[model samples]
Target chain A: MKIETLFIDRAIRPCEEIDYIIQSTSLEPEYVENSKVVYDHVNLSDDPITKGKQTLYITENHGAVIKKCPGTSHYTCCDYTILHTGTFCTMDCSYCILQAYFHPPLLQYFVGQHKIDAALDEIFKENKTFRVGTGEFTDSLIWDKISNQPAKLVRKFADQARARSRSSNNNFSILELKTKTVNIDSLKDIDHNRKTVVAWSLNTPKVIKSEERGTASLSARLKAAKECERWGYRVAFHFDPIVIYQGCEEDYKEVIKSIFEGVRVDKNVDSSSDGVIKQSLGILPESIVWISIGTFRFMPQLKQIIENRFPKSTIAYGEFITGLDNKMRYFKPLRIKIYQKIVSFIRQYAPDVLIYFCMEDEEVWQKTIGFFPKKEGQLGAMLDRSVMERCKAC
Target chain B: MLNLQTTISNSALLKKRVKQVCLDAIDLSDESFKISSDNLFFSGNKSSSDNSLSNLTNLSNLALSIRLTGLINPIVLREIDDKYIVVSGFKRVSAMRSIGMRETPASILSHLDFDKDKTYDFRFYEVQSALIAISDNAFSRQLNVMEQARGVRLLKRFCSSYDIAQNSPAIFNVNMGESLINMLDDIANMPLSLHELIESDKLSMSSALKFKQYGYDKSLIESFATLFSKIKCSLSKQKEIITNIHEIAAREEISASDLIESKEISQILDSQSDNCSSNVNDENQKANLIRSILFNRRYPNLFKAKERFSNNLKMLNLNSGMKSDIKLDPPADFEGRDYTITLKFSTVEELAKKANILSALTKNPLFGDITD
Candidate 1:
């Protein structure tokens, strides 16, 4: 991530997070009364979407520290809880909902920890199982360019999991720190208690090149996942916003192959191998806790946003129809065909890997994966079971 | 009271401020100051423009009036390199020229008056001339969207985009923004056929941009203009037709012009003309049929799905006796699973009858899959 301009909110200026951000970046801090000032500054630029990434707003997290994912309940959601540490990402993606999600998107990180800690403490106190993640709104590791925020979160999740390890029931909390960056140095040697699932959002190489600008390359993300797994953390991968294009089936299949080949052999590989060379040390497939899949979908308003911001992008011009949830989705049979192909390829390597769809319908699940997780909150239960069996804390 | 005061004050101020006084009037009695019919005119080296212009409407009436009344309103001209360019009265000049009048009385911009040229701000004079031309037309009648767009384009040479943003609503009565400004610029520069179509209210501004963006040839655009001039369609419908054709052309790996010339569209036009060339009733029908044909070609999958749904629905044969009380509507586009069933029964006896009918209908073989 590149940090060219830094803004410190007056509400958070006296905090320690500001000191850390100032020391990490050489740019002089431009203190503002609120986020609107930074948004005004960013929207004045030629390209607010790209300009927003280079500008960072170190504001206070006054909103809800954690909340349900915005995927409407009408669609089949995984019931994942969002640890809202921030609001936007530095990465510029052509199909990114955040571009239209925020009212003039900016790189805003919520500083201070009491609100999130209080929210997580309540979650940990519950007897029910919960899946929590910080990557919902922003990439988990993007802040590592200037702050060790992910490590701080890992410590909190790990301590809670360790304290609750004695429980006999299958009740646990799993913190999934998902990212598309290779900033995993702070995560190493953090006593994570095998409770934090460090995950990566994977895509085809063509998609990464043409759509996801400034994100880590496929091999680099997989290598980072391998390193995180080697450091005793459960790793996960998300094949989300899977763009459909010519030869994308082959491209995504290659991504699935590269993912397994990069980290999911028989736990034996040379430490610095370029994927081919091997030794008696490698990451195991068991290190993968779960993988989530979702085809590219967007609100109708986002199409115009993408067209205006990324005029070269053709992602919105698919054989799309309004889905039940009113977001534009690929025609049903088309989504089924692509989903079946991608799932079969993923199963070729890690057959036992717990793969789930993010916001798919029951018909889609039945047609693509041969089962529907629709009855009695079955999808969330299935994910909770996956978390319990992988994390020793439950 | 304050609001009324503000409105009155703003109106008076606007009226006072817009009284442009930079003109150096020439005596019409002096033939030395007047330019003849042979003088050349261009839109000021193409830097300034009177764009989005077409043939003057009601030219015959104006010519008749000129023949009868003898050019009551003298034209105004500006000197340029021994030739003359029109400053105002564009329509009057065009009407006179159309009537083959070899000469006309006119006033020259006193370029020799030097009071208007003290600073030599050539850009200023060009803008002043364009503004005068626009105001003269606007004072008599409301300028159409095209004329407003042209005025903006011409003034933009002297005014910044910010100037347009600040003053456009007052000057042209059109809200100006970056995207709208660029779109209007494109509209101002569109080919004359598309311009005529928009100005005649046959086509719309959005449809004009669609044609311009596709880079369709003059023949194709003129085909649409001619079609629209006869068959009136809404702006959105016109846009839809052009957009679908554009997509279909790309999918077929052919140019849009080729698609317009293809037998599919040409046959539609030909069939309509063959039916009745002058029937007003056929115009809208022709438009709807053409729109449907283009829509069916553009969305093959959706269209096929709709057809399948319709065929399945027809299988119900609901036109049977006593089943007239029942109506079934499938989910739109077959994109959903919900089916709506309505029963028209007003009393218990009718309800019981409907119940018996519904019972018998459930036993029918096609009832189970009517939603398909």
Candidate 2:
């Protein structure tokens, strides 16, 4: 890969000395000579980077060392945690918020691994079983196109934690590099435990093909996820930005069907056998993949921004109304309808696996997941609590 | 869920002029008048694309409210492309529509609300041009001091551009554009109670206008907002703090930042930690002891605890698992509190299975009646 030179904004060009491989090899001298590069080196900056269909911004969030996300926003379906590697995506979804989030936006990767490391150290020292991922700001693995940075980070995390384990022993989760790209070959070589859950963002076939651009095909992404699962790595799937198109019901059904075909789950062993029959021979039918669905949602102002930025795109002009946060978008009934369909499908196919929504409220959690947390983080606590109860009973 | 049947009755409420008027008569050709029926109307949806119904729901609910009060607070509208556009009162329109009314009365006005010194209008002829620069089905722009100040200034500028009826109240006398802007700024800064008070007409302008300079933290504002919106409570400084603390505790886990932020609490914890470490040599000794103390117990007690806990948890988890098994129909035993649970036998085998669960419940004292 040849380097390209272009006048990139200073906002994206973080640390001056950084190694980057130019993904596009057809770089002219003019493209490379005048280019300004950005990296992540500063404290979290508020400036947003806006592109054609994407904009990236940063906010200071002090949250759980272990975050809960299967990607169900109260509005959208799946809510998964991204390690907040940086704030901007490389892919261009027509409905992406990045287009309006950043001004004069450029692809900016946060290069301040040291600050991240410090945060991780503080988090790991607490050693309170944390599950974190690094796919929030940007695609988890797209940086691999430039360099296998995530691979390096994961390696560093695994090594440091191992070293610390001998003295101040505490269990620490390394990282889950989630993506919609076929960028897992680099990750395959890295050693990871069940502590790391490699996740992928999936949408209905209609959504992935039409709305999400600059991303891998659904088949390619699923193939990679299946491979990861086959390698004995626990994986996650996100059905996010579940666009409410004309044939969305059928489209989502196909998605769930394909997921089952790809990732096998055993029905009889799931909650006992009456639902799906099993013989004494111990033969069991294949099951579906664990999945999470997030209804389509954006920040309150994002709809207006999308309207302001991509007025031609009908994705924003769907059936919507004002929600609790007062952003002008979708109506609740439609959202519930979409959510109910997706949940039922996931339940029917992948009966045993964990399924959840991203960023949803308590009511949706109860309605969809069938259990309300006594409090907010109780959803995550429930899983742990159940496991502990089961093991300790033995 | 707020019970649909439990909704407050409005039979005694007098309909406002806005609700009596026709929507078509009000000319909704202007793009702003036509709202897409997207899922954003519901609350707490994070997608920027989703519209928060706060403004819409508030406006409609306000209409329902004004109807109760026998008042018609005029909503400002603007003329765009020869059609009257509603810059506000979107909720009022929806509320009116919900009641099967066609038209609602509105106050016609200019759309420009900008700093008195500056003026620029974003044109929207074809819809596509209006959507060119943004994403996130919703808004992410932080309303900073600069934006708020600019809004305040702009409203003042726009107020002078519009006609003021002499009989209008004095609060409405000031640049309403500015008043609205200042009100929003106050809202941005105001405790939620004050916001609710303002929204619900519980707080007068004299009190709410004060919070513009001093901003309450988000929790205080949201709690105040919720109390005022839902419970229609008046906001006070002390109440704001209490409600905010309560709501925060309910929503988020207790964190170190939360513990440390309270200076006295931090001091107390620090002293405690210091006192504890004075007697222990191992760094993790305290943690291990705490863990053991928490987890260590008699096996018999633990076994009993596990059984009880599992049974309780199983009830919770069973709702999801047994959703198919459970029937929505009420039982014929005819006791309201007893909840006569009815089971629709899917097959003969399923009927036998239901009998088994019922028999088991009867057999074990721990298992209550399946028909809660």
Candidate 3:
């Protein structure tokens, strides 16, 4: 959160977003003729990754603002779309691919609002159901104090959803703002119309403390989700990069219980029934749309980075093999076993909620959830159906 | 015309400064004067007499160059009252003395330049001489590890006495940085055998430093060096073994030397054949045995569980006429929870054969033991 320096591109003229960001932070402005100065300085430092994290660069997107997710053909992708709002994240997870994916690893935020708007318009014109998220390259809410991108994008999607409803179209669009932060103040007063699903990437308390440096605690994330649900917003949970360690199953089970306890409620139960009556749980189960379970997987290059950066991390020591996508993944049976346990827990609590796998095969689906999507695009359609049904768009 | 004039004037000034500095310190009336090789003494403890200079493998080449060029470059010396001390060119001086040369060309720094005051700091003068020696060799060639270590040792000693920049280790031809200097310091204090291993390039500085830091006994380090030298394992493999062994010893609350002397490790070490017929397979087996033993000791529970699982798997004897057809799901190590048995078959007959094997395996008591 403490940015050491801010490098502004000379080509980027003053705008509301850039001005808001520059004024919100106390980091001295270092106006550069080109963005390469920040990159070269970061790369030449003693610890490039750490130094890069401390530095911030504001530049134009210079490319398509909306791009398809870089999913491999070997795996079953969910047809997720990435809104290229930024790159690099503040919070450090040991198995995070961004550590190796980016060369200099500087925290870069694109200030090309016109480009993003144009891309979104193109997406809306085509208007099939698309799950666009800004959490791929960076956390959606990390720049909450500096920039209003989350609220801006959330309102944009709300307007688009309204337009679609007025036109009586069956197809709907969902803007998913996924993050590890509990910074939901910007989303509090917005009329999202349930088109903006506030999602949190969840992990066990041990991982949250050890590997996910500078992230909101599990309780804090669930609390934020609860608040979002109360604000008439559908909420989602992603247990992605679930690490396997000693007692991880029990830890994850505790996390699941807390999630349901914090957000979902048994609406049929009355609080004043009898002596042993239990209060109706807070947030409605229907408001909770989908939960994705993805085990800890990493690009092959991340192994050495994790070893160097987080030497004490035992996450890489799990039984792993090169997956079809060429990422190091837990052995199939091992992944399936972890998934089955988690799915069983989720099913016990909220059976109607849409549960899907992120970048998994048909076999993993059948083995873990006892059923696989019949064909390609079924997973994406299932997610879209959840959006329309839960958000009352259909 | 201006550039040529500037170059000529700069050259004249440089010659004048060199002559003035030399004359102010010592009598240099005879510029090519010679001093007896025996009269030239090396001031520092790191000399050929201390066996530190024994690794200068290119000394013969230098001697050959001197014999041909007739000592074109004069060795720098410090005139301490009546004694002549060789400050730089220890190798050249030793080479000249070795070839029965009576005298050698030299440049003398008078007592004024290297004076011992009432508050005398011997290390200061030693470091000054070391800098000159390192600079003399900087253009000649790169310094070996031992030379770098010796130079850093002198610089560190001087920096401790004088207020100077103690960060960068890029002195002369050695640029190992400060951390390596610390490693070299630790290496310098290690036992002779460990030093020999490092000097011979059989063991790395990092591994040697780890051994020293972990308090590995001299005999244990020597034994590993000996075994590694025989097997000719790669540096990474050697590092793995050393690291795991150290961890196991620390975890078991025993000395590393004691762990090396354990029955299991000794057996693995002794299994290597010294005969000329020993092939690559034998060496690989030996390395594998050592690694397996170290891993077992490090993770006793996992190893025990794996052993039990393997034995139970053998008890099933679920041989479907081929080894690849039937296998345990999730394999060994219990990294995953599910223990379903998977059998692959191509035809109905093969499936029936696999079913029969599974049926027999189900009856075995060890079938239940496999998951446990």
Candidate 4:
């Protein structure tokens, strides 16, 4: 959030989107002919990762506008597609893989909106349903104040959904704006037509305070999700990178209870002729489209980064083993235990809500959720089906 | 010109005072000295009492040098109540004794008027004498850890009774900081074998200090010091191994002695000892093997994971082909969820062969285990 310096590529200086972003911030942009200067400056600092959070760069993304998520080989992937708009994020999480993935760790925003629109249009013409998100490399809504990209993307998805509704063939797409921020002001007035799923990454209060820096609180995020739900927008929740610590289960149970309290759910009741009534116990079962749960996992190289950045962190001091994917993870039994507890808590509160495991294998699914996706793309299809059943445009 | 005149006048004045002092002492004649080597006492100097110093490797060379050029510098001694205490020239006297010479030239400074006053403490005289001996040896070459330890040990005694500022010039001359003094005091009380290991540079001073700080039992310290000298390792590895064992013992609520006597550690030490006796050529490799075993014992979960990964790699059976060309790249320490399979080929035939191997490998269940 505290971007100390803004470096604009000479070519992107004339970009209208770049001008809009510059006009909104108090940062005076320093025009650079090449991005290598910014990279060199960041890498030369004493703490490159911390310094990187303070530096911003505006440049063009020459690569594909939409790309497949590079999921690992052994893990089951949901076939999620990413709308590549930038690299690196402003929020500083101790266990974030971006700390080691990017060398200079520069916060780069791509100024290629035309390329993105064309890519989205091509996807809209395709016969298959696409589940696209823009929060992989960066937060989806953190840059809302400057560029208003989320608002534009929501409108674009809404238009595509409306077009599909009129066509004879079935073609649909969902744009999930996943974020840890509560920047919902720009999203309030947009007519999304339920094509945009506003999702918040949820965590316990302890983790948010200790590890997640510069992010909204748990209550604030849920409040924003409640606001979006009231606007006729489909809402989703992601309890990802769930850190396992002492007394974490009770904390997570309370969070689950709060989620149901904040949002509305469908209920059914039956009454006999004697005026007796029996009500079904379900919370947010119909309104909350889906929830994904993924435990804390990291690349081997991230161990050193976490140690250097957060020396007092005990998150890495767990019983871990190298899985087939060659990443350090909690011991199989430990991960299964944590997941089972969380899944049970969720089922107790919202039994009928769509619950899926993000990047988890079939065995884990079988053990925790009592079922697994039949095939590779089965999870994606299930998510698309959930969207169709929940959203308005479908 | 005024500076030059002052220098000449001061030199003359210093000569006149030296002559007067010598006259008052009344022992200017060389015959007054007993030149017999047996008459000289080695007990006065603590460093000379070392048995290792008596058998110095360079004694013969010094003797040969003296035979060719004679002793240019006379051995210095102090007359304490008709007894000559050696203040300097321990090595010279040692070389003379090695050549079986009974008599040698020496200069003796008897108790003078300077020591008559209460301001001139006899303890100060003893400290200054030891300092002179240490400085003489230090100027010729670098004193080894043992000699330095002896010197620092002697100075530490004076440090407690006198102000540091008053005695700092003598202490600091040998680089004796408080920490170094503490280390030397600890080392002086250590067993002779450990002292020899430290003196020979096999064990570092910092590691020795850490061992003391960890409160290792005397027996455990001695056993480890002996084991370390037999096997070779870098200083950091040595420190890490010691510290790791200490920490593991603490975590397990066992004494360090009991931990070192554990079956796993004992087996490793015995096997390495056997390997060492068989004359293993790669010392570092042996050391690494020992360290790996220690680390595995300390972290069992990681050990099991590494074992499983190694077994899984072997299950791939990349060697089934007559010419193996495939490589599996797992993430470092299995800390990430990615694996890469690379096939190497130099010719079209090799490429075809690799493709066939890959097709066969894809059918195996282990392939799924590696890449879902």
**lDDT of each model, Cα atoms only?**
0.72, 0.47, 0.70, 0.71
Estimate, for each residue in A1-394, the C-alpha lDDT of model 2 and write its tens digit.
1122322333334442243433322222121222222222111234232331122222223343334444423333232344655545667666775555554444544555565667777666764445567776557787676555576666666665575567675545445667888777666866653345567888865667667777877766666677665554566677877887668898888777766665322442234335554322211112122455667766666654554444345565454444444444344446667888888887776566666665555556666667655454555554443222221100
Model 1 TM-score? 0.82
In terms of TM-score, which candidate is strongest?
Answer: 1
Report the C-alpha lDDT of model 3 over A1-394, residue by residue, as the tens digit.
4678899998888888888988888766889998779999899898788787878899988887888887776667888999999988878888788889898898999997778888887888765888899999899999886889899998888888788877856677889999999888999999887788889999998998878988887766776787788889998999998887668899889888887775322322222235453322444678888999999999887876776687556666665657766788876666777899999988888999999999887778888888888677888899988987887642
Identify the leading candidate in terms of lDDT: 1
Clashes of 1: 5
Stretches of candidate 4 exceeding 4 Å from the true structure: A263-283, B1-372
Best candidate (score: DockQ): 1
lDDT of 1 by residue, B1-372 (tens): 012223323332221111112223322233321111111122221111222231233566678899998977567676556455566665566677678776777755542335654754344445555555666656655666677667767766666656555656555555668677667777867666666556556677888877666666667777666566555677788887776776666546677667766776666565644475543256567688778787777666777777776786677766577778688776655556678889887899999987898888788878776643
Best first by lDDT, ranked: 1, 4, 3, 2
DockQ of 3: 0.08
TM-score of chain A of 2: 0.71
Interface RMSD of 4: 6.5
lDDT score for residue A332 of model 2: 47
Better of 1 and 4 by DockQ: 1
Model 2, runs deviating above 4 Å: A1-17, A22-82, A160-170, A263-290, A304-312, A383-394, B1-372
Off by more than 4 A, model 3:
A263-284, A373-375, B1-128, B131-195, B204-232, B239-286, B294-372
DockQ of each: 0.24, 0.01, 0.08, 0.11
Backbone clashes in model 4, listed as residue pairs: A325-B337, A325-B338, A326-B334, A326-B336, A327-B334, A327-B335, A327-B336, A328-B335
